[model samples]
Target: MVVHALHIRPSRPGAWLLGLLALLLMLPAKTPAVEGVEGELRGAHRWSGEVLLSGPVLLSEGASLEIAAGTRVRALAPESSLRVQGVLRVLGTAQAPVVFATPQGWHGLLFERPELPQILRHARFSGAAAAIHAQAAQLVLEAVVFEGCDLALKALREARLEIQGGRFEGNRVGVDLELKSFAEIRDVHFVDNAEAALLATGGCRLNISDCLFQGNGKALSLLQKISGTIHANRFVGNDGALVATRLGAGLDVSGNFFEGNRVALASNTFSQPLVVDNRFVKNETAIASDQFSTGEFRHNLFQGNQSALINTRRADPLVTRNVFERNQVAIFCDFASYPQVRENNFFGNQMAVKLGTYQSAAGARPPGAQREAQAGANGPGPAPTFAEERPLQDFVDVSANWWGADTDLLASLDEQGNSPIFFDRRDEAEVKSQDAFAAGGPIDWVRFRPWLIAPVADAGPR
Candidate 1:
C-alpha cells in the first residue's frame, strides 16, 4: 500500500556526508622538508630514513637531539663519535673555532655526561682518542686546542676538570687523570708530548698553575696515588720533569721553572714530596730521589745542572734553604741515601758534596763492633750504606748568602770522602760575576738574588 515512502530523507543523506568530512580535515597536510648544512639541524619527528647527515650517525638512546655550532663536524669514520644522550650544545668562538674533524684523521671531544656540566670553549680538538673524554662530567676547558690527540685530556671517573687557556700538542699523554679525578690546570701549553705532560692516576687531585711543560716525555707524571699543588710552572725541554711514583702523597712543589730538563725531580718508591720555590736550571738531574722517598727541599734555585743532586737508596731527606749554582755535580750521595744537608747556598758547583761508601773497606765495621756503633743500626742497611749521623737538625743562617757562580767550588769527588764544599756566603754583592763558561751565561739566580728572603717566599702555612 504505501509503496511510496519515496521521500524518506534521513537528514539529507547523513547531513551531506558529515559536511564533506569536515572540509577535508581542514586542509593542510603535506610536510616533507629536508635541507641542512649552514649551521645544520634536523629532527621534527625525523623520518626520511630517520634523518641522518651522512656517515656514522647512530645516536639512538632516546632518539634524536643533534645540535650544531658554526658547524664543521666531519667524521666519515675512523673512530667517529658524537654520541650523546638527549642534548648537545656546541657553541664555539675565539674566531669561531668548533671543528671536530676526521675523514682520515682528526679526533677530539667526547663527553658522556654521567653527572652533567660539560663545556668546551674556543674549540679545536684535534686528531682523536682524546682531546676530551671526560666521563662523569663537570669539565670546562676554555680556549681548547689539543692537537694530535692520542691522549690529550682523558679525565675519567669522578671528573671535575677545569683547564684554562689550553694548547696541548702531539699528545701521548698530556692530561690523563684517571679515577677520583679533580684537575684544575691553568694557562696550559704542554707541547710535544711523547709520554707525560701531565699523567696523574687513581687518587688524583692536581692543581698545576700557569703551565708550560715543554717538549714532554715526562713533564709531570705522578702515578698510583697523586695529590698536588705545583705552582707558577714552566718545566722546559723535558725528559723527566717531575715523576713521583707508587704511593704518591701530598706534593706542594712551589714557584716552578725547572729548565732544560733531563730529570728535574724524580722521586721513586713511596713518595711524599714538598719541593719548594723551584727554579732548577739546565737540568740533567736536578734533584733525583730514589730509595724509600720523603722530600722537603726548600727555596730551590739550583742552576746549570749537569747531574746536580741525586740522593740514592733511603731515609734522611730534607735538604733545606737551597740555592746551589753552576752545577756539574752539586750534590750526589750514593748507595746509602742520607740527605739532611742543611742551610744550602753553595756557589759555582763542580762537586759541592759527593759523599759515598756505606759498604766498602771490605765491608768494614767488625774490629770491635763500632763504625760509629755499626752506623747507628737501623732499618735499610746490608751492602748499601751511608747514614753516618744524618738527622741534621736546623742550621739556618747561611751567613748573608747570595752564592751564585764564581767557579770551582771543589771539582769532582765520587769514590767516597765527598768534597767540593762551600759552606757560607751571605751577600758577596749578591754574587754574579758571570763566568761559568761565559758568553753571558750563568747569572740570573732570580735576577742576581733580588733581595734574598726566599725560604719559599714567605714559607708555607700562609
Candidate 2:
C-alpha cells in the first residue's frame, strides 16, 4: 500500500526559471549546418563551415582569414578562387549574412597585398569573375552584394576602396576603376550593368554620392584622367548616360537625373566636366560636345531632347543657366564650337538655333590633336577626325537668351523675309565683348545680342 510521494515545491524558484525561458522562446529556431571546406589557407584561418571553394585558394603571406556569420561560400567553377595576400576579416551580420556563391563562374575575391584594412561586413557576392578584386589592398565594403559579375568590383593598382551599402546587379562592368583607384561610392545601387555602371580609367578617384544608375550600359565611363564627384545621381534607362572620354577631367556632375538616354551626356578627347544641376529628360542627345570637349553647363534642364546641344570638335562649352525645352534642335553649333551661350532658356524649340555651315560644319579638330595620325607636322589629325565632321564656327554667342521670339522678332526672321526664326547675326556685338577668344572665321555668323523680354523664370522646367 506504499503510495508514491512526489514532493514538488510550489514556490517560485525564479518562477521555474521563467517557465523554462518561455519554453525556450516558443522553440522553433534551428540553424546549424556547417560542413564544407576545401584546401589551402595557411597561418591563422578561422571559418565557420560550408565553404567549398574547390580550387585556387591561396592566402599565404603571414596569412589570416576569418569568416563567420551564417557562412556559405560555394565556388566551384572552371577555376574557383579566393586569392588574398593575407588578412581578410568578414564577420558578416545583417542577420548573419556572408554568402559568396557561384553556379559555374568563379575567380573572385582577390585582394592582393592586404595586411590590414580589409573588412567586408554582411557580404554576398555571386557568380563571379570579379566580384571583388583589389590590387593594392585596403578595402571596407559594408552591406555589400554584387550579383552576376564579370566586373562587379575591380579595383586595380593603388586600391583603397570604401563602398558602403552596395548592390551592383547583373554586372558586366559595375565598378572597374583601373590604375590609381581610390573609390568612396556611397549608398550605391548600379542596376543592370551591361557595360558602364562606372568604368573609370587610369587615374581613378571617384567619390560618387547617393548613387542609383539604372539599366546601365553607360551610366558613367570617364576614361583616362578620371577625377570624379558625380553627386546626387539617378541616371535612368542608360545607353549613353555619361561618357567623358580621354583626359576625363575633374568632374563635378551635380544633381543628376538624365532620363531615357541615348546620349545623356557625352564629351570626348579632352573631357572637362562640371555639368551642374542636371535634369535632361527623354534624351536622344542632351549634350554631346565632341572632340576637344570642354564643360561647365550650369543649371541644366533640357526637356524632351532630340538634340539639345551638339557642339562638335573644339567643343568649348560654357552654356550657362540652361533650360532648352521641347527640343528639336536647341543649339547644335557645329565644329569650331566655342559655346559661351549665356542665360539660356529657348522654349518650344522647333529650331531655336542651328548655325551649321562651315561646309555644313563638322570637321575641325585642332585643339592639340592626337587620336592617331602622327606623320610629320600633325597632318592627318585635324582632318575632321569625326567630331560629327566639325564646322559650325559662324560666330555663335547668343547672349542673354530667351528666344521664344523678340530681338526684333529674331532679326525679322533672319534672311530678312524667311521669318520662322533664323539668325546669321542679330543685334551684333561681334567678337570683342563676350570675352573674345577668336578662331571664328568663315564669314563669322551668330551674335544674337541682348534678347530676353521674358521667360527665364529660373531657367528650368519650361
Candidate 3:
C-alpha cells in the first residue's frame, strides 16, 4: 500500500469555499416539480410545492387530500373552487406556511360532510368569495390569515367550526354564521372589515373570546335569535361595535373593552341580550336601543362617553350596578321607554337621566286610517309584553341611585320632596299611572326617588 499524506487548510478563502461545496454535496436537493390539481380526486392524493388549479376541483366521497408545508396554490379563474365532499388536511409548519392565493376572484374552498373532521393550520387565504365555506362540516382552523375576501369564512347549516389564532382583515365580513351554525372563535384579530367582523343570523350560536376587533364597521352583528357568549374582547375604532336585532336573546356579553366607536352597542326590534362587566371609553353613544328591545345592563363602566344609554320606543332595559362617569348624558329614555334604573352611580355627568317623548308626524299615515299605522314615533306597535300595559310597559323606576350628595343638585333636576315624579306633556298633570293607556301609548313618569347618598364602589371587569 502506498502511504498518502492528508492535506488540511486553515484560515483561507479558497478553503472555506471548498468546505461549503462539500457541505452542499452532502445535503439533499429540493424538489422542483409543481403538481397541477384539477378535475376530480377520488383517491388519496398528496400535494406539495407550487400548485396551479387549472380548473374547478372536486374531492369526492372516500377521497382524502393532504397539502404539505411550503405549498402555494393559485386559483386560475373566478369560478374555480375546491369542493371537498371528503376530507382535507393541510399540514403546514409555522416557518413554511401554505398559501391559497386568488389573483382575481374565486369561489374559495367549500367543505361538506358533517361527520368528517378537517384541519387547516398555518394557512393564508386571500381574495376569494369567502376564504373557507363550510356547510354542515366539522372544521378546525388555526393560525390562518384571511385577507381581501368578500367574506373571510362562512359557516352555515349546522356546521361546527373551531377557529383559533387567526387574522381577518380587509374583507367585507370576517366571519358569517347562519342556519344554526355553532362556532367557537378565540384569539382572533379582526381589522378593517367593511361591513361587520362577526355576523350571526338564523339562530346561530357563537362563543367568541379573547379577540381584537379594530377599525371595522361593525364588530359584532346579531340577527334572528342569535345567542352566545362574547367575552374578553377589545373593540376599538368601529362604527358600531355590537348590534343586535330581531328577537336576539340569551346573549352574555361581558369583560369587553370598547373605545372610540360611533356607537358601542345598538339593539333593535325586541332583542334582549345580557350585557355586563364591560368598559366603555370615549364612544359617541355607549348603548342605543329602540323598537321594544330590552336587556339586562349591569356592572358596566361608562367613562368619557357622549351619552351612556338611549332607550327609545318602549325599550325597557334593566340597568343596575353601573358606573357612569364624565358623560354628557347618563341615560335618555324617549318614546315610552320604561327602564328599571337602580343601584347605579352617576358621577360628573351633565345629566343623570332625561325622560320624555317627542311627538312627530313625519312618517305618519293619514289622520284616521287606523292609528296602528302611526303607533310610535320610531316604529310600529311594540312587541306584545307580559306587563299590565302593553304600550307603556311600566314606570321609569329611578330608585336607589347615587347622584352625589348635593340635595341642591337633585332639586335642580326638578325633584320634589324625596321623590320626583314627572308627567308626560300629552297627559293631564293629575295622572300618575299609565296602566290604562292603549297598546302604543306614551309614558308618564320619571320617578326619581329613594336615592342613595353615597357613590357605589367602582367594581367591574376591566
TM-score of each: 0.34, 0.42, 0.82
Model number with the top TM-score: 3
Order of candidate numbers by TM-score, starting with the best: 3, 2, 1
Query: Which scores better on lDDT, 1 or 3?
Result: 3
Task: Please give the TM-score that candidate 1 achieves against the real structure.
Answer: 0.34
Q: Write candidate 2's Cα lDDT for 1-462 as tens digits.
A: 233333445684666666666667667665554434455678897777566766777887778989998788776663767888888898888888988767646777788877688898988886677777888888998878888778778888888889888688888888877898889888888888898788878888888888888888888887888886888778888888888888556878888788888888888887888888878888889888877787688888888888888887567778877888788887876545777887777777777776555312223434444343343236734343334445444456676788764456665543424334443333222332221222333424665666777767777522
Tell me the lDDT of model 2 at 315. 79
In candidate 1, what are the lDDT values of residues 92-135, reduced to their tens digit? 67766666655434344456664446566676766677656677
- Residue 207: error of model 1 in Å? 20
lDDT by residue for model 3 (1-462), tens: 333333548756588677666666666677764655689999898889888887889999889999999888887786778999988999887999999877656888989763689999999988888778899999999999999998889989999989999799999999998999999999999999999998889989889999999999999988899888999999999999998998557989999999999999998999898999999999999999898788999999999999889987668789988988888878887655667888888777876666554321111112232343345434766633333322222346687888764434565664433222223332422323332233333434456666787777753443
Winner by lDDT between candidate 3 and candidate 2? 3
Q: How far in Å is the alpha carbon of 436 misplaced in model 1?
A: 45
C-alpha lDDT values of all predictions:
0.61, 0.74, 0.79
